[model samples]
Target: MSKATTSKARILAAATAIAVEHGPKQLTLDNVAKKCGLSKGGLMHHFSSKEALLKSMTENMLHKLEEHGELLKTRHSDALTITNVIRTKKFINEIIGMNEAKILLVAAIENRELLSSVKAAMLEQKEAIMSEPKSEMATLLMLAADGLAFQELLGISPFDENERNQIGDKLIDMAIALEGDLHE
Candidate 1:
């Protein structure tokens, strides 16, 4: 990546880390600049406003999903079994618990354009899932993942790695069992 790209990524990372540590309500461009070791003017050179930075963060979320989109398509085209689908669902659950998702939602609520863009992407993803045979189950998995992630971010859920893993395993098993029922 170019230096510009690297720096922008660093800024976004800094912003996300901060928002994840403190709710989005407390986030500010000055804080982000300090976190990135850049002057406020330099940060402005990259993103003229906090809204713009938040929008970038939202775009970053879609970029992440796109990273897995091709992989998911490939898996769907090949093997395409229920077990693989369950595994993918579990993976998404784990990803939602990640800091990235926390930042995405935080940014979206603070920036209207970011919220709209992210909502569009989410709608598209939902439509894609609806096109699949296991639409209902897939949608449920995604909703659960989103809810769990938000709860984790808000400290409403325990963030222990072991507990997360166990919950993931249970969710996957539940999906598999649901798939079996659909088959019958």
Candidate 2:
């Protein structure tokens, strides 16, 4: 990567780490700069303000989700299969573990306006799902995935890894059965 790109990535990493560690309220350009081993001026060159940095972080996360959705679309032509639902859960789990999802949650709590882009993206996803042949099934799967992620994001998930995996397997089986019924 080029110097600017590297620096921006580092800055974002620092910001995300700080948000996860200290909460979004503690995230500041100076702290990010220090974590990135850059001067405040250097950080400013990349992110002009705290709002800008947070906005960038949110956008970056949404972009990742969009990319994952695209990959799912390619992998599952139906776009609402049991395998795809499981994959969505797995993707959300990965994001939660990475602390990126925490950043978005924190950002939303800190400033609702910061999540405008995310809301828009979700709306688009909803519309796409609604247009699918199995719209109800797709919506249900999406809601389940979101619920799992939300529980993790809120640190309220009662299921351990094994239990969670078991639950996921059950959900996948149900989805497959539902899909079978749809074609019958």
Using lDDT as the measure, the top candidate is 2
The global C-alpha lDDT for each of the candidates, from Candidate 1 onward, is: 0.72, 0.77
Whole-model alpha-carbon lDDT for candidate 1: 0.72
lDDT tens digits, residues 95-129, model 1? 66467777666765775566787788668767766
Off by over 4 Å in 1: 72-97, 158-160, 174-184
Alpha carbon lDDT of residue 14, candidate 2? 92
- In lDDT terms, how accurate is model 2? 0.77
The TM-score of predicted model 2 comes to: 0.86
Tell me the alpha-carbon RMSD of every candidate.
3.6, 2.3
lDDT of 2 at 98: 41
- Candidate 1 vs. true structure, TM-score: 0.75
Assess every candidate by TM-score.
0.75, 0.86
Q: Which pairs of residues collide in model 1?
A: none
